[model samples]
Target: MHGFCMLNCFLSRPDEVTFTAQFDRPGNIGRVHIGKAEIEGYKSKVGSVITSRDFITNSKGGPTWRLKFEICTFPLKGKVRFAFSDSTADARDFDDAIITQQETVRATPEGHENMPENLNNLAIVLLQRFKRTGNLSDIDAAISAFKQAIHLTDEDGLFMPLYLNNLGNAFLARYDRTGDTNDIMASISAYRESKCFDHTSNPFYIQTAIFCYSRPATDYDGYPDDRLVAAQYWVGLSQQHDPSQVLAAYSTAISLVSQVASLSQTIQARYRSLLKVSRLSTSAATVALGLERIDLALEWLERGRGLVWNQLNDLRTPIQVMKPSGADYPPANITEELERVSKALDRAGASRELWLAPSAGTSFTDVRALPGFEGFLKPLIHADMIDHLPASGHVVIINVHEDRCDALALRRGVHELCRISLPDFSYTKAEGLRESLKLYLHASGARTRGDWNATRGMRREGGSGGVVKNILRDLWILVVKPILNPGLCGESKSLTLPEFAISSYIPTFQTLVDRVKKPRKVEPENAGIFMISQPGTPNQSPIPKPERNAAATVNRVINIMENYTCVHFACHANQNTSDALKSGFALYDGQLDLSSIIQKQLVGAELAFLSACQTSTGDESLAEEAVHLAAGMLAAGYRSVVATMWSIQDQYGPKVAEGFYASLIDSESEGLNADGASRALHYAIQNLRKSLGDSESSLVSWVPYVHFGV
Candidate 1:
């Protein structure tokens, strides 16, 4: 019924903090003092009595709370270092140069080749030493070591990923060393590349380590409250992963143990008794102290799971059938502990969504600073009206929804679009849409859980559509309008409809526009004409496939333009937006589509960077999202497009679109074809990207900027 209690001795609060001893350890170093800083290790083996952490060098996890605490407080003082055994570079490798074998597919690598997993473990030990001795040189050395690891450039795929992952650890160490955004992003990218290489399709396991490694430190740079939040986040995140491996990592990397100074039997016994008494009298003995060592806590909890499983009234037999694998994972003492670990891991594994949900240590600054932060949000688009933009001086349109909503699964979101609409008290981004959706769902006989979390998994049958609507409503009101231009929100019927870009792809006018009349050696003017998406380096020795396409297209189009500068981009479009739909105007061999069919691949553009919808949409709105298409011509040197807000129907696209190009050309000078077209097209797309709040912006199909050049 109750949990096994341990004497938790940690710096919970300054001045009033209490310290107690659990027992004496191997090679007792000295007499116990209440407050002097100490260095020790925690050991699972009995009678070893923890001494130095290096006892287990091959394994790089457990705890270093005391050391981390010191680093967090005076971050400028600590540093980290690393040494790699292998490194490489290979062009055939679609994987970043990182590799690691993991326990599951969801947490494993997705590509054939891998980049090194970034890390810097040795530097961590030195950092702890710096904390104790205040050695500036140590910090500098750690920084240098990590940077060297990051810039490791050998074009051959010959290095080991373990070392690469450790290089990532350097970023973790630096972030702890300094609460700088660059370090966090660098760390995130290193890990992401790791996923691209390894065979596992999942990216969660690496994310877990990154999260813990970057956890805010207590009294970090002199912020005690921040330290508390950091610790809480760590515990929450550590517990969120599966028990088999995640727990071990939490134990190895996060917890720090101090030696009890091996004592005689009488002294050791007395120490234990004293610690127990202190637990009752001091606040430091509360759960939070032990909470930091969640791995150990989880170990204890697993024991408790036995009884807890039986206690569950609606438990299934299959779940109970899952037994501990051999002696390596024996049953634990408490049933509830098992329940806790199991629940946390299940939730973590089940929810693949990278959320905007409140994490204990999360902030906008940290999130935005993460590498590819902007790219991450591209996947969540819902409705886009940028292409067929309707113009209203000011408007507020609301669709109450055909049915009521489930009050239990979601919350209302509200935000003022920066330049789009006037500030209305009741109108909000996600909140208003959520409200209408809930009402509609309720009318339609939807159910609810006590409290709600908007994960896609926890929705009713008709829930997703309504949810998407609200999300679109929110996306328009909050993110899109503010991003495109908030001024539009002031005069228009502020309501925006939904469009799922999942149906297609679209190309740019450049695909339709004429190319140079002839082809020749590289010229400076051609720079803006096409950009190559070489991996590793911006300008590599080999031109990419996209660039090759650009060359071929420019050659053909230029010949046509020389005779008659009039043409239309003939291609397919889909229902997806941004990268999903593959945007930017491009031209690919028509036979390429046939190849996709033969190969059984998702046939499309080389870089569907920013797409709104596919040309494949149904001829009419009767099927709603039923008919959608994709469009784009493939070209060499180009990767994708950074496009408009969201989905846009086909009919309205060319109309509002025409206005964009006209405005663009008006801004350019005569005789400057390259400059004029580039600038003009960008202007047109950006203009169309804005929602004027007219009937045009609400077509509810695909939308995105098309990129097609050299």
Candidate 2:
């Protein structure tokens, strides 16, 4: 008796045929024939017949016969007939037949119209095999096939990039095996050539390029700079795709930025490194916001913005002394080691070895394991930020992207987050406003002393001042008004202020008189005023300068900060665009920079009124980072800060200060309300606006005043 089955299959490339057969009798034989051509090397037609005894026993204790045949030795095309036969079968089973393509059969009939595509496909198959088997011959064949395809295809054809990209893959795969620098360079050259294709004309080609580039960009073991370059390439290529794809590319690039500017480097080095990817976070958040993923946008902002400042906060976290009851504290020695590493990390030039220390590795993990510390030293998620919101007021974070502008407001006691869209505001408008304000400042010389004397002539000329007025009005209508909508921030009257007395300590400014008088004079030890002023100027009062050195000036200010409840500055502030840490307030002889103040870490500081030029103006390149003097004050332990977004008019400074102080000090309670700093600034700016025509024209004088923190 005999049993047989036949299947006709088409051959597109070189392939293999495999099947398993089962026989019950010892003398039963199985044979495979392709179009009457029997396979050799197993049981040759001229030799002995293979019986069931020669087959291996399967799991079911039945004899099993497995056969494999390579199609490369046969014809390249056409239907091939496959037949299976079992001899002397009581019952024979033939199962699990599979045809696996091993490689691409070279384009047949020599001058085919689809020859280039066939060669390209052939190269891809070879390249894939090379990757799997690490075979040099297969990669070489792939590279050769790819070059042939490229030579045959038109230069402007869509398939050209595909061929070049495959060639690059072939070269890159070869480089992995041989470690040859030439091969790697060749791979890069191929990829560069592929990118020369016009993305607009063929978006599919661009997407293919993105896929090819993303592989190396996200490779975990790749060099940071190399990965960054690939990631940037991926970002550029992804722009042709949809916004969601573009956002994914930006997400990848932003993540790679941390590797480039890691904490193992010195703070200065990290900042310098980050300058390469300046505004990257804002761009990513903008993309995320465009997709209406407000939570994702916030998360990206929190991850990428203020990175250095956040690192400092983490390093200086007082985890060593934190021994909460019922919590599993780390051993005393572990805590001590963590303290040592934290201090070392905070130093100016922390070495990489400090980061690699064993204690540094395990310290944060152990600390985070303790109760109420799970989020310690980690980037705060949206939920974590909401949980830490102040008890009474809303925290509105505004993000300005080119696609859209939005404000995310987290109100106290509200579990749901509110998103307010500002349709009129855009990144382009903001940039334009910034440029116009800058031009007005430069044309009118409205900096340093905050004097508006130079601006009077320009205002009369009606060029710069009118432009600034319109800019401010636009800011109000487009950005501020939308955010201040009652639905988001609630009514102004509903805001509550934390009770505190500024009469405890006050830093007297140059223009201030007895406008902020103490309700009742206290003992000298309990109440005091410290003044810092530059000499050789008008209204330079009896305030004495202890030392003229910049360091001495910083030390004096820091000492006052340690003792004072509130400090006010009516001096010139210079914002360092290159190094934000160097941005500071100009004092008697020199400048007291932000870095100096932050290093001191003052305690019991209540409020800081920075009534100076550009106190809140951050570096444009580091827009997401709060690297201005106002932010420095907050980081240095001030509960509230009143700062100027631009240069304030010297004449109106005193009036604004008077209004701010008056609004903060309650006559009935005889105390200063620190939490009302935001409200007080609004009150002062409104007063200034009223005095200066109470219209768009007044915006120039009043708009610069801004309040930061509660």
Candidate 3:
């Protein structure tokens, strides 16, 4: 039986070396010989044999191996030669030859200094060997070799970052064994300093720096403050580069933040850590604001908040959107044969994570090169975007920070951005309120599974947590009422009521009950019923045929979304903590997830009323970041969104729905547009308060409703 053969050569001396010969052939006894070199124990039955420095092949099978080996001293001019019988053997022999050449040159100080490239190459191989065998000596050798190479290279040369990155990696490996913090610190410093060099043109070097900073020894189990500082540093370094580098940096920083959350022993601690890291959004916002670009600022805020999931879902966009355009096309198109190849290169260069597939192009150069893609993915400028809002409503942007909160109010007719001070509002206070709300709702039996019909019109405020009521009052007085201003809400004919569009997806309650009872789909009488009405023409509204699953809901919406001016979804919402972007509506058959809604990028989606539980709530760790369905819809191109901050009672769902649509339809009939959503919701909540006849219960029913987008 024919089997394969392999040869390995070890260069122990500048003038002489040794070779090891091995074969895959079992029990085949063969003596190996080279021109002037002969294997010791040449007659052994074993497949491997060692040979002296001078090597040549002599076997019964003519020209058995094609590998050509030549050992030269001094100027290293001549190449020793013998051809391998197979191409595979040829490639192996060629690689071995280079290794031998590098080892010989490294034998002398003069030779090492004269060829820095050779030294760098040898260092990479040694580091790889260290990885394979976990040999400390190999890593040490790699460090010494890379240091020499770095010293010999010019400061401005392209190879400098490569050399420095490799040296840093070698030190990190040694630090792991010796527990020497100094070694790790030195590695981080080297990596940070190397970024100053013009290595932006090289993808691998950029990735190397990111890897070094992200994997610093100080990051592992460090104090919360220390880890945060390290994460900040990573994000800072990431911002100094192009869009691709920024994405990579934030991706790693998000992981670090998640790790911080996981390391916490309590939910409160985790929330606090998340609050601190919320600086991620503020920092990105600061940069975007400096550019005088509100659209980019919004994108930065959204992307910075939901870093991990955003990056994962970012890549899932269309390849046409990912195609290289501007400056990248002339060079990139020639270099990368296919758009897929360009995408592959993009994934290779910018991704910090290996677990998920790359969906978005991170290369800033590539991003800017695409037509109309400047300022990072066709930003929706403040002017153009606000046009989609209702004339009767004001757009309030609440910026939450550590020191304070600022609410910026903009209306369709207003030219100036009005700043409102929220001196009493704070993140800590908001969190406390949230906790109180959760406790109150749980104690009140609001979220419990039951026939909500049986409990209709009943006052269920047993746990009457007064804190939530006070918080709502403060929100109305401080956040909402102040933003509405004195003259904005006047009965002005110029500011007509906003148009209305409504779509409700509700799996039959009986089906929901039966499924929960048996953990499977229930073929009940009315399984997948959707209720939709033509805005301003609700009298002629029709209830569509019952669809079977989530896909049907998605497809139905896709068919009707363009027909309606503003859209609303009244369904069950689930906020997926494990993967926030996958969080979505629980419909028949499946989930109408964030990914689907976002990917749609609806063109004329003016307003979205997500009358679902926790529509505005996201993972606490990403509190400052907009990782909720509302933000997802905004990013998906909706101008304004009405969502819930927390779950509301099932009974109130109908009241809120009926009140919102009636107001919206009336306003639109008079030409106000849909901007009345916020005001309508406010009035609806007020009406609910009147009906409840108590502050505490009303807060439970209405406080969860919040506005997003414009």
Best candidate, lDDT-wise?
2
Which 10 consecutive positions of candidate 3 have the poorest summed lDDT? 503-512
Q: Considering lDDT, where higher is better, how would the candidates rank from best to worst?
A: 2, 3, 1
Provide TM-scores for the models: 0.23, 0.60, 0.45
- Residue range 1-710, candidate 1, lDDT tens digits: 00101111211222332223432221111111101111111111111212222232113233453333222211111110011111112221101111111111123123312212222333444444444445566555555544443455343344435445554665666676677788788778777766555654356765655465445442233122233335434544445544333443333322211112111112122122223222111111112123343223322222111111111111111123223333223233222333343333222112221111112113222423444333221111111112111121221221111121111010112122112222332323335664654454344322221112221122343544545444555666544454333454554535442221111122321221112211223232322222222212212122212213333242353343222112233222233221111222333322122112111221121222222223322222112111122222222211222233333333344554466346534654432222233344455544554653222123222233333332
lDDT of each: 0.29, 0.58, 0.50
CA deviation > 4 Å runs, candidate 1 = 1-524, 527-647, 669-693, 696-710
Give one clash count per candidate, in the order shown.
172, 0, 31
Model 3, 1-710: lDDT tens per residue?
A: 11112222221231333222453221121222221111111111121222322223333122323121211221121112111212123444334534654654544456334467666666765665566567887788788888888888888776788788888888888787788999999899888877777536676776666556666524443333445566566666666654445544554454455444431112223344466676775655555454454554444444344443333223333343434344454356433433443344223122222211212233434556656656543323454434444344454566665556656555666655456667777767676767876666666655542223355442444535475656566665555554554466454323211222121111111111111222212133322213432221123222222222233355676566654446666556677654455677655445677656655544445567786667877666556545577766655545457787666665676687778767766664333233556667767766886787545666556656776533
- Residue 690's lDDT in candidate 2: 63
Model 3, TM vs. native: 0.45
- Please give the lDDT score at residue 148 for candidate 2: 86
What RMSD value applies to candidate 1?
Answer: 28.5
lDDT of 1 at 65: 36
Quote the lDDT for 248 in model 3: 44
Better of 1 and 3 by TM-score: 3
lDDT score for residue 250 of model 2: 77
